[model samples]
Structure formats: C-alpha cells, structure tokens
Target chain A: MKSLFFRTISVTFFLASFSGAALVDDHIHGGDSHLPRPVVVEYSDVESLASGNDDVRLWCESWRFAGEANNLGPWTTVPVECVSYVKTYMTGKRYAFDLEMVSREASRFARSIQMRTDGMDAWVFDIDETLLSNLPYYAEHKYGLEIFNHGLFDKWVEKAVAPPIESSLKLYEEILGYGFKVFLLTGRSEAHRSITVDNLNRAGFRDWERLILRSLDDRKKSATIYKSEKRDELVGEGYRLHGNSGDQWSDLVGSSTSNRSFKLPNSMYYIP
Target chain B: MKSLFFRTISVTFFLASFSGAALVDDHIHGGDSHLPRPVVVEYSDVESLASGNDDVRLWCESWRFAGEANNLGPWTTVPVECVSYVKTYMTGKRYAFDLEMVSREASRFARSIQMRTDGMDAWVFDIDETLLSNLPYYAEHKYGLEIFNHGLFDKWVEKAVAPPIESSLKLYEEILGYGFKVFLLTGRSEAHRSITVDNLNRAGFRDWERLILRSLDDRKKSATIYKSEKRDELVGEGYRLHGNSGDQWSDLVGSSTSNRSFKLPNSMYYIP
Candidate 1:
C-alpha cells in the first residue's frame, strides 16, 4: 500500500482540472471547511498530453543541465506522461552522449590544473548512477510500475552486482591516473555503507580516499542542502575539490563544488 | 464569474493534498475512470509546509535566482500555506529592500559605464509592477480572494492612474538622465498600447526608446521565450541593452539582458 500511495501516473487527470487552484463552483471553500473537490481535465495539445505539466518539462530540462530533480524513486514513472520521451532518454545513444560529456569534462579538468604540489586534490563521485549503471533495475521495475521496494534495492546493493557505467568509469580511471584523490559521495544512508562499498568494489570502482555517506539526521534535510553541507565539510578539511561527478545537480552546484563538475544521466527516478 | 476562475487564496487546500498529482475522489470521475484515494502527507519541516509542493518552492527559488517558474497565476494562492511567510514577503519593509536593490543597481550601472561612446545603449523594463504600483488594487482584490475581473482591471488600467513605484521611478529617471534609450517590454498585447503609454506617463515614466507590447501570437509563448525573442529583435537592430528592470525575473533574464538587470518586489501576483 505504501507503493500504492504514490501511483498517480497521469498528472493530466489531477493537475489540469485544478491548476491546483481552480476549485469547484465559483468560490474556493475556505481552509476550515473545504471538502476535497474532484478534478476535471481536458487535454488538447499533443506535446502537453505527452507530459504531466510544465514542471515535468522543467525537471527534464534541469536534469539535462544540472542533473537535478526531486529524488522520488526510479521507475516510479507516473508523473512523466510522454512514453517516447523517456524511451529516447533511456536509450544507449543518450548514454553515449552523457559519457561524452564526462570524458570532455575530465579532459577539461585535466588540462586546467597544474597538479597541485602540496594539497590533496579530490574528485567526488555520487555512487548510484555515476559510477554504476542501474538500467537493469529500472528496466525490470519500469517507471510508473510497482512502487520502489527499498528492501529489494538494498538486496541489489548487497549483491554488488551492478555493472560499471562505462563513460563514468572511463572518467573515474582518467582522473585517478592524473594523481587526484577520488572520494565517493552518495545520498544513501550510512547504514548501507558496507554494502555500498562492496557494490562499488564489485562493480570495478577502485577508490583512494573516503566514502562519504549521509547520517540518519542528514536524511531529513533536502538533498541540495544536505549535499551542500557535505561539500562545505570537505572544503573545511582543506581538501581542494577539483572535480566532481554525479547523476544529480545536487552533486554539482553547491557550497563545496569543485572547479568543475560532471553529471551523468538518470531519469528513472527523481530525488529532491 | 469568469474572473472568479482566476482566484484561489489558500495554496494549502489545493497544493498540499494533490501536489497537482493527488486526485479528488468525486469530480475526477467526470474526466475519466479516476479513483479517489485518501491522501497521505507527512510534513517534517516548517519550510516544506510553507508553500504548496516542492515544485512550487522550487519555482519561487528559481524565480528569485534565474527567473524561471511554471506559468502559475499570481493569485493561485491555493497551496502556499504559510500565512506569516507571505505576510512578511509582502511587507513595505521588504519592498524597501527590493527598491534598495534597484537603487543600488541603478547606481552601479551609472558608475560602470563610460557614457557608452559605441552603439545606442538601451534599457528594457516590464510594464506591470515595474514603473507602476498595483498595491492599491490588490489591497482590495487580494490574491486568491476574488476572481480577477478583466473589465475592472481594464478600467483601472484605462484610468492611467497607476502611481509610480518610487524606487523604479528614480531608476527610470536616472537611466534617462544618463542618456540611455529605454524600452518597455511587456507581455500585455498590442491593443493595450495606448492605455499602457498613458499609464506609463501618469506613472511618471517618460522615455526615449519604445514601448514594445506582445502581439496575439506572442502572448502564447512563455515569458522567457517571448522576452528573449524581443531582445533578439532588439539585438538584431544593433541596440546594446545596457540594463533591464522589472518585477518579474523574465524581464531581467534572457537574450540581450543588458550589462545587469534589476528585479523589484511583487509576490502579490506571479506572472508566468
């Protein structure tokens, strides 16, 4: 039922009638006694019919630019109405483009720095979709399908069976070869640290430096704020964040953001 | 009654329950075979609860920074639940801060330029809430309280009686004093041109350049896209936009967004 609580796939049915403001009759019933009103919607435009709302389009656009969105869950695909859009997004060709971006960023990062002589230059990588591919899981679960099963996901993590994201892996290896210390930063709770590490290792991620995980308290904060604080802490330690990689904008734009950041693609879920 | 379609004051009653994704149990049946489900909302923070959903908050923040948000109407006050928050935001003291920002920007623009010996320097300002204050009208109407009456609003506009926003008035005069050509870029259609000009004059905005209004087709585009295209046209004409001022972010951002842009305070209504 927890999964069912989130299964409203067609936003047109919900948002169109209301605009979240259009109430029943002429007047909006006051806060004290307003009964929930049924939503009535009519769709005319093909493009709009393809997606939920402008918010959805903005999410896709923002993710393209900064890998940012509310982290709801992968394959919880009800909000995004356009079937072909998501299909094209999940294609291998798109993956190649994302990898190309990472490669280009890595090359740019390498060319920009003089290889700091004294301080430890660090590069942060968000685990889930940055270094490893979750397409298999998403393929099975599918967006807007059954609700995300944390236990199942945990088991998947424990298996450490996810394959390496080739482009990110290439970028990872390239950065390591450049004498930069690599750290892994993820939103996963610290409780899952051991399995996450094992997963990273099994998926061909060899790391030198720390693996940062969110503590229980950090889970309550928004992803952007939480990640920013983490970056702040990293900077406080006198480590220069020269480069960063993640599949979310929260990983890239924030307090301790490095000189440059690279974002991978993951439209299966949105994490705010 | 048609005007009433535009107003809804409690963002809480609307946005919270639905996220625009929550469907009401009854009226939704009119649209299709949509079901009514009990909504389960868990609010952990004061901030998250102040507005409608994360999307709304994101829109507000984005509008603050880069001037991006879905085209939610200004009085769509159905989801923003924090009364005191909106109260503080609408305060004259806060307006003073906004004006101070405008003043500071004006001074900065004045000091930075060397009397631009090159191309014809230009400045763009949006009409509503930029040169004129709509506080008096909104004071009576109040967001989300009554329907937005176009005839009544048109009567108000036809009066050519909107008072000059003090800070913007100062900036407007200052820009003209410095010999920069001024243009009013607004989403208001061409039919409103005469009254807009009269309103501008009554509001003490006298200028050198032009007042560019939206056409029938241009009205369909988003604010950013429309404003950007206008700026593109200006650029094509070889006008270098040196400064822009507006109450909305769309005016300040986009193509030919001058050397700097200033945004005024007007949370009373959101325009796109």
Candidate 2:
C-alpha cells in the first residue's frame, strides 16, 4: 500500500511539473498578491517602455494578456504587441468563437440541471461586455489604443444603442428558456436603469426578472464585494445561483461564486 | 447628487471599456467554473495549431501568459512562446522578486493584525514550490520541458535535498518571530511525513507546529475543497489564519481564504 501510494505522489509530481504555464495564468479575482506590483511609471518611462523592458512587458502583458476582470486604470502607454492582440481579438472571429464556445458550455450546464420551478433557480449576468458589445464604440476610439475617455463613453452609454453580443444573445435566450430566473446585475448606475432597460430590450434581451444596476451606494465597493454581496442577498432569499457569466473577473469571482461560471473573451481592456 | 451619480457610472464605463484582456486570464483556484474551459484540441490539429490560428493562439497564450493556478492536464502542445516563457520565468529573477513583494505585503498584513497572543494566530504554507526549490530537480529534468519522470523525481524527493527559496525563508522566519503558529500543509502523501519533516528541517524550516500531509483517503478531493476544508477545521478551532502563500492557486483560493494571501511565481508548474 505504501509503495503504491508513493507511486501515486510520484505520478502527480510528474504531471504537476509539466503544466507550469498554469502558474503564469494567475487571473486575479481577489488579491492574488503574488505578482510584482505593476510598474505605475510616469510619462518619463514611456519612451524606454516602448523601446524594450521585459519587466514592463511582463507586467503590461500580464495585465493585457492574462485577463483579470476589471475597469481600473491610468494605464501605461500601450505596447506594440497589444495592438496586435487587440486587433486579433476584436477584428477576428476568435472573439466570436470563444463566445459561441461559452454559450454552448452554458447550454450544457443549463441542460444538466433539473430546475426547481420555484422561481428560485437563478442565473446572474453582468452588463457591459458580457451581454452587450461596446465594440463599435471601441473601434472609433482607436481600439482602446488611446487612454479611455470618461465623459465621451458616458455620453455614449446614455445613447442606449449598444448592440447585443451575438453569442451571449443566444445564451441569454437559452437560459431564460431553461426555467431559471434571470437577473441582470450591471455596473451601470441605478439612475440609468430606464435607459439600461430600454437598451437591453432594444438589443434583443428580454424577460429578465430583475435589472439590478448598481446603486449610488455601491460606488466605492469593489466589484467582487459588491456583486458577491448582492448574490448573498439572492441566496438569502432562497435563490440558487446556478449560472454566472461575465467578462470581468469581479463578475464571477469572490464569495457567492456561482455553481457554474462562464467567462467570455474581451482582450482589448481590463476592469478591476 | 443625481448628476454626480451619472458621472460615476460614466467614469466606470471608460475603465470598463479598454481592458478586455481580463477575459484571458482565468486564474483557477480549484475550479472557478466560469473560467472559459481551456480549449482542448485533437492531436490531429497540431499542424493547424502551429500555423496562424487565432483560437489556438488565444487558448495557448492565456494558459502560458496568464497566471492561473493548477496542474491540469491534457494541455495543448505548449506553444513556442510558452517555452520561451518557461525558460525566462524559471531562469530569471522575476520569481524571487515576486516572492519578495508578497513577503513585504504579508509583513504589512501581519503587522496590521492585532493577534490575541493566545498563540493561536497562525499562517499556512504549502510545501514544494512555496518553501522549497524544486529547481535543481527541474534543472536536471529540463525544467519540465520534458515529460516528468515519476520514479526519477521520487528518487530525487527521497534524497531530500531541496533548498529553501530565500525570500520565503525570510518570510517564514519573520512570521515565526511574530509569535504566529506555523503549519506546513503539503499535498505529499502522509506516508512520507518522516522524510518530509527531515527534508524541511534540513532546508531551514524548523519548529513548524504541525506538518499536515494528505492521507490516502484524500485522493478524490480537489485541492481547493480539500485545503479549504482543512482551513475550516482550523477556523472551527478558533485559530485565525492571518496569512497564506503558495506557488499554486489551490494553496490560497476558496472558502476561509486568509486575511492576507500571497502567490509566489512558479510558471514552471501548477497543481490543481
């Protein structure tokens, strides 16, 4: 028995050793706290940053590349590779393919569950990138190559004209069909609920049981804490959050993590 | 107040706009069910994968570049960039540097906490990459460039000559000096406790109050569930887990997550 046990540990070590890439992919939901603090350089560092620095590259690339969900930054100047990444991500079909893949996975998860029919079976969806495409807005703005502009994007949101992400659109309909209550938990402020509702309706989203936009009170709370607290409320009311999907880590990470979570692709930007 | 509220939501949309990269870094602590399931492909797809395939690149790049924690298997034939990543990561100073940053953060967490001095304040450390360097073993084994050899690595473990990671060694000592009880929670099978103790002692980890190695019965438990369950046990006993660090995501993620958590760089390997 002992010999056999040693053999198993040995085998685990072998398999464990080979997948080292997994370590580098530490996407932060809470405090990963292991990565070196991102170099928040001044404008002086931009020239040297563009020229070459692996540390800066790693920091910038991990933020750009690894996909921790967030919307916090006065970012360093964009890297040359990032343009390629953004292009490949936005212009190409890969983004669409990933969404299709996730929707398919969500469909599978929804199908496997036997719903209670109590209106207590719930699935949460984060607004913004998860359900809607801000691509057209991003495209006109140099694909996020330039620093983000607040007033302009807010003005853009006020228009309530963003289109549905085609892939998520399918998943959204399918989940509604699956007898689960749908909750739209968005970072959009509560004041914008009417526009947000109209936007979701116009974009082909319909029949969600609740559109829970962030209240003014939740402004200072981190997305994880805010979302999780909301989820706790739902759970406290006997809701079973079986499905959660979002573009940002905060949407699905931290407490009250869903029974099955799905992350879609969006490589052009990050949110804290 | 209403105008100010709109302003906040508007400001959020802008930060939310540019950072699409978070979609790629799906850091897994055991199973963040939402992480886009890694794109697994058939062996037949290698030719297409090696060619300019965006899906393949996204799949390969997220795993290689992002910092997810696990030792999941059937990973894609690692891309060329990953090889370079592994080489640069294992051979470079980044790993140690990240550890230093985490240690410093942990020091802050430790100092901020007012421990009861009931001697029940504790910290948890995962063995293997967290405390000991398996670099020597990996060096001989191409730093996991090749398939791991179980018998060979086990023989290496039996030799019990792993060195202490300098940064972690300091943190361990400092945490100990702070009057916190130390626990080494390792995934190594319980059968190896004696050797594990001798090895840790030889490598400068002395006076740990308890060395908890897994029993044969734990084979079916996922690391996150298993580790979190153990933490629950500790918490039930009224020990406040003040700090935790590990090279693997499994070491730190999930329920009873510590007050402060730190991850060490180990792009060379992952254990689920």
Candidate 3:
C-alpha cells in the first residue's frame, strides 16, 4: 500500500510537472496579457529601499563597487541583505542571476562533503520547510498569522495537505534507510506539538529517533540562539553532525562538528 | 562604524529589556475589556483532535498501553499515519509537560558524556526555531499564506526583528571564540539559502566556518531513512560532534559521537 501510494503520488507529480512547464512557458512568453507583469527591481531601486539605514546603504554601496579596481574601502561590509534581495527576486530564475554564484559556491561546498564521506553517517534536519513543504500552508495562511488561530493551523497540519518536494523527500528517506539517524530540529513553538508530529507522520517521514521543538515555558533563549546552544549541548553529549539542512543559514552556523551544508531553492516571493 | 553600531544595538537591547518586559505585560496580558480574549486550547482538546485521525488514534492507544498487562494485539494493524501522529504528538509534549524528567534524562546523558570525553570537543545544532525565531514570522504571517508575501517577508528579514535569546547567543559566541568550528544542521529546505543567511547576519550571528542546509537537488534518499547520514558525513570530514542541542529526539537519534544532547523545551508545538 505504501509503495502504491508513493507510486501514485510520483505519477501525479510527474504529470503535474508537464502542466507546470506549460504554465511557465505561457507566462514567460506573455500569454497572460491582461495580468500585470512582475517588474524587476533595479540596483537603484534597491539602494532607494536602503536609503534610511546607513548600514544598509553602506552595504549596498559595497556590493555595487565589489571587485572594482578603484574602490577605496575593502568589501568587508557584507551586504547580506542585498544578497538576500537578489536571491529572493531571482528564485526560479536562479540560473539567470548573480545569486546563482552564491548557490554554486554553496553547492560546491556540499559536493566537497559528498566527495569526502565514509562510514555510517548522520544528518540533522529542521522540520517546517526543510523536509516537508509547509509553504502551501504558509502561502494559504501567510507566515503563520493563522497558526495561532485556535486549532485552525493544527487542522491544516493534521490534514497533512502540504505537498512534499518529491526529490528532496526521496533524498531524506534514502539517507535514513542507509543506517543513519535522522534528527529533526524545529522551532514550531511548544503550542503545536501534537499537530506537528501528526503532520510529519502523515507526510510519511519515518525513523526519526528524536523530534525537538521549542518549550512553551522555558524562557532561556531565542529560537536561533537556542539552536546554536543546542549544537554545543549536542557536542557535549557526543553526537557528530555530519551535515545540516535547513531553509535558514542560522541552522548551519554555530557548531564545531558539521563542515558541509546543502541548501535548497525557496525563492517564491516569501522571505522565510 | 559597524563596531559602533553593534555597541549601540547591544546597549539599546539591554535597556529595552526592562521596557520590553513592561510592554509585553501591558500588551500580551493586557486587554481586560476592549481587546478580544485569546482562545486557549486545552490538552484534552488537542487529544480529541489527534483522535480524529486513525493513525494518531492507534499510536496513542499503543503509547498509553505501552507497559500494561494486556497487549493490544501487537498493535501492528495500526496505520503508519496513526503511529506517526501519535509519535509526533507525544514527543512534542514530552518536553514541556515532562521537562523535569526529560531534563533529568538529559543531565544523566550529559554526565555520561562528560565521563566519555577523551579530550576531543565539538558541537552540533538543529536549525529552524533553534537558531532563528521563525515563529513570530510564522505567527505574524499566519503560516506563510499572504504574509509570506515576498516583499514583506524580505523587509522583515532585513530588519532581523527576531530578537536573540541574549544568554544563548552569548554562549554560542563564547564557544566560537573558544576555537570551536560551530556546525549547524536543520531540516529546513535547502531552498532558503539567501534569506537564511540574511536573517543570521541581521541577528548578528557570525563567524561560523561552515553552514549546511538540506539539498533540494540531491537525490540521495528519504529523510525518514537516512537518519545518521549527516553525522557520518561530519565524522568523515574530520570534525567530531561533541555536544548536540535540538527540540526533537530525531536530531540526536543516531549521534553516537555526541558527548551530550541538550533537548530544548519544545512542548507547545511540533513541526514535521
């Protein structure tokens, strides 16, 4: 039954791909003449957005003059925000933007890890958008304003209607089947524990020896800071993090064990 | 200038805490007459919700009867979905409702590691809510529907409004300053590279030698099956995962090298 279900979902996914391609083509070629086309924001426009914030303005200027011969100051001021904007704006069209270089660099790092691995391995994953697709819920609801809406978000999670990224999900399960312990770390507040677990189970993610979430009453750290601290605690406990996965870079930072990172693509108009 | 800005932000942050606490009390707990009261869901209601799903029902039944004299017919007939639902729900609440026990277990685990450490040191972290405050964004945007609006999300990230858990962030920096390489692992999709980096930078998280995210293009395996792949990858890469922290059991499941696993408090919610 499981095989059959996977097969069914796979087939539907493939079929959907064709339709998706057609839609992309139609839109790219201006098929929807009545709809207002997305305007690409220029460098100038970005600078304008950063006008009030000197830090941002300096960052933008640094980016604009990056690698220029006559530039006086060092490009030490990493305009992380500008990179973010560029990446977000060029989501699906990654190949066409400079941001692809960043991805390529990151991918190269991932590939280096792949080239170096030997023996029984393990990787930790953050739930939400990492292994499963919470974007649909996020898209339908927005960030998570609807999450605190009583049991509404819980219902959505229980339904497990959010679709899976077949390629990624398959990869995750494959890694798990290879005698690796798959750890899931999430910041899905302590308030939605049941629903979060239900969502993962319904989604068919298995063999998770541990599922970690934020505590409701523990008032010690912010989610991101807690994650780093957690890594320290993990090391103190004796677990070797082979590689880490997440939608955010913070997940990959603050650990002495993990050396490689694998990033996925999620530039579909939302920042998180 | 950047140094000055950091100093200012830090000072402001410390001063803001007093005012912030007052504000939180005034706003979050305020609202006696005019504001609509926030609805609180009880544990029983959550159980009822879980019961709606067959998979969750059977899993819960098995869990409830784990050590009972009467065996429940092997409980194998329960659908995988139910098992998963129950698992996620149960584990999600285990920490909050059972923090004392969990902490005791964790401390025991920590003591064991303290004895096991043979002079090597490392750290592992789970991303998502661990290192980043995605909840506010998730809550404010209602799980990513319209509020995940690309532009708006970008603005929020640029601001990096998600406050750091000062104690935790300081601890992480201290670790890094102490010569730790700092590794982070998460289940967030690899698709969130740019914004994740941006968010981290905005939050003042810096100096990690490596950042890892889940690979969207890698067709290695399923997340359920490849539990310890990342840790193995880390070991293969020559980094020892000394301590680990996460809100999920899965994050620490296969980490044999980890000297300690600090399970953060995550009972209110669980994300698959």
Question: Candidate 1 residues A179-260, lDDT tens each?
Answer: 8888887777787778777778876788658888777667555566777888888889888887777766556654677766
- Cα RMSD (Å) per model? 22.6, 12.5, 28.5
**C-alpha-based local distance difference test score of model 3:** 0.40
TM-score of each: 0.43, 0.64, 0.31
For model 2 the local lDDT of residue A91 reads 65
Give the DockQ (C-alpha) for candidate 1. Answer: 0.02
Model 3 interface CAPRI class: incorrect
Q: Model 3 over residues B1-272: C-alpha lDDT tens digits? A: 11111110000000010101111111111111122122221223111223334423433332222211111111111122333443343233221122222222333233333322342355676654445544455445433222113345445555655644332354466556555567776654455566667767776778766666656432233221233577777777776676665554445545354655555433222221
Tens-digit lDDT string for candidate 1 (B90-123): 4433344344434543555555677676648888
Docking class of 2: incorrect
Per-residue CA lDDT of model 3 for A238-257, tens digit only, reads 66666666644345545443
- What's the CA error at residue B86 for candidate 3, in Å? 50
Residue B43 local lDDT, model 1: 28
Q: Which candidate ranks first by lDDT, i.e. highest?
A: 2
Q: Which stretches of candidate 1 lie over 4 Å from their true place?
A: A1-80, A144-146, B1-272
lDDT of 2 by residue, A1-272 (tens): 11111110000000111101121211111221222223322323112222334444433433443243221221322343456556655665445545554564566568778888577999999888788878778777767565445557777788999888766777789898888899988777777888888888898999998888767677656567778899988888889999898887668878787887777666654444
Pick the winner on TM-score between candidates 2 and 3.
2
